[model samples]
Target: MNRRMMMLALLAWACTAAPAVSAASPPVDDAATAQALAQAETRGREMFEHDLAAERATDALLKKRMRGDSRVRGWITEPKDNRYEVSMIGEGAVVLYRATTDARGILAGATEALAVPAAPTAYQAGAAAARTLAMQSRIDACAKRYNSVVLPAPGATTDAWTVYLLPATTDPAAVPLGGSYRFDIAEGRITSQRAFTRSCIQLKRAPRNAAMIVTHMLDPTPTEVHVFWSLWARSPLYVTTGEDVIWKIEDGRIHRVQD
Candidate 1:
């Protein structure tokens, strides 16, 4: 079935199955309340499953059009404004998709992520300083040269930016993929910083050519910044040995949970 039809069917089911919430109403039995909650949870899961399938399908189409030889390695979806930001990883590109869906049983426009034409003057200064610090602290002798992309973070309440660094060298010995750093600027100083590196994670595995990609920035709680990513074996097959991870960021430190 088409996406629209699937969405419509799911919406109809949700509307029909939802239990009515009343003000001055009757009390429910324990079994009935539990059953209602389970049904509601089931409905929510189905909707999420449908949306995920649709998003993956869209990613595949975009990937084919942009680079036929590459595949989407991983993606993380975040809700932003009234839309969604889907950060996708391919062989050599970090593509971002801006999506508006999951409303009224319809999926609306999907397009390339829009970026500021230029960082505001003040932000440029701050980001430059922060970048220099990031390079000094994180990058080591293994990197020959690197490029960076700065984008406004969706949910950070402060003046926060996420920078992705890409290696520009032809040397195979260098880190295949580079780093992702979160920088928060305040009063011309980098108030907070956090980083993730494939080299650090791969050292544990030892002697294998490996790479890490930060696929998604997870929603935050009061005290943490969470993200999801993948680790791959840089072999002929591009084997994904480490399927997934959830990294918790707090106080300039990162802790990993493997899944």
Candidate 2:
């Protein structure tokens, strides 16, 4: 069957499933609710694992087909409800496809792969950044590099607030990937981070003057606020400026900035 058919089937099945009673029932006390949550988590894990495996398989297949093609790096997989988005990279082209899987972990519904322009350098940089940011040990490095701006709110005393700033490549030549990022710090130790891509940017045809805008909270002291701006560059041809702000504290957080 085609991927569209498989997706339709999955949608139909999900629709037919019986809905649970008591929409507000807590999972801890409700058996059915607990089971549903567990199942969802399990499915998420399984989907990620399967995606990894599929990427490896696709990589090997591409290597064989290309015959020692150094430009052919690998594949990345994104899983959906009943289908997967797979992108295979090569020297000058990329093959993108939507693949459906069967219960036995076999590829079932398959679509004709679409060839698109490739951006090897940009892809490598993005993949590297992703891997590095995903590691636990890198949290501190990331935090230190992109620390939160703390400032006081106007007309408020004894109340200070801090907001985290996300790290990004400031390279003008690099493609811009939109996302909101936050870091969790406890007792001076970085705990976790919440990061996601809001939209994907095309690297192959990225504009020459591409730039990213990042904003963070300032200190909660009316005296003075220090703003730090850091940028990473893929080339040495770009120029940028850092903006400064002064603010006051209100309600335990920075409320206003002196414009």
Candidate 3:
């Protein structure tokens, strides 16, 4: 992964699988874990919001310069000491623009003139950075085939990736089931990939603030992208892992269900 990817581990903490929950036994949330989850949730929400702001900043320039152009590939959010660096990539496989943002997702110390284009950022400075862009572009291209929302996240270690192709649809009534995929990339190649299910599974949207129960038969724990998805959905998720261990995902954090 590059500096721009997984800039800061959400909450600067490692997410792990929580112990299983037993309905018959009353559950109590762990004090430390609960605090970590809450802190991570706040960070994730802020990251999501800031990333959107970066996109808006880049889009404004795109509209003024290359109107109706799809050469814009995608972007990566890099967190700084107390700010974020958002680089907008173009079809040339280079950063065409960059934006800096503060904590509130507001444009801070960010300005660029559309009158003169910035010199293309050399993709060769760092092999990992270049490869990251290449891999992201590859996924971006394939995303067209699956028609799912593709999110690329940094893996536990650098030079590793976990990309989620989610069935993220806006329609609240009919959830499109299927076509969701999770890909693992490392050592400059796709190491392994898995589909969440053989086909799509549609479930009704829970009311605001209500948690939806979804059975996830893949990992023993919930993935980071799941937290991001939960944040976007504006609702919480009660995910039943393969081991029947239940966890709660909300506000971009996960914790063992306290029943």
Give all TM-scores, in the order shown: 0.29, 0.28, 0.58
In model 1, which range of ten residues has the least summed lDDT? 221-230
Residue by residue across 163-190, what tens digits does model 2's lDDT show? Answer: 2333444454443322324443332344
The most accurate candidate by TM-score is: 3
> Distance (Å) between predicted and true CA of 4, model 1?
40
The lDDT for every candidate, in the order shown, is 0.36, 0.33, 0.51
Q: Lowest lDDT 10-mer window, candidate 3?
A: 7-16
lDDT of 1 at 130: 44
Model 3 earns a TM-score of 0.58
Tell me the tens digit of each residue's lDDT in model 1 across 1-259.
8754464454334324433111121133377644443442333333233334334536544664334424444333434455443444433333433344443224555445334222224444444444454455554433555544344443556556544443445544433433434455443455666554434222111133322222232221111111111111221111111223223222122333222
Q: Count the backbone clashes (under 3 Å) in each candidate.
A: 0, 14, 4
> Which candidate would rank higher by TM-score, 2 or 3?
3
lDDT per residue as tens, model 3, 163-194: 44455455665344345555665545667766
Rank order (by TM-score, best first): 3, 1, 2
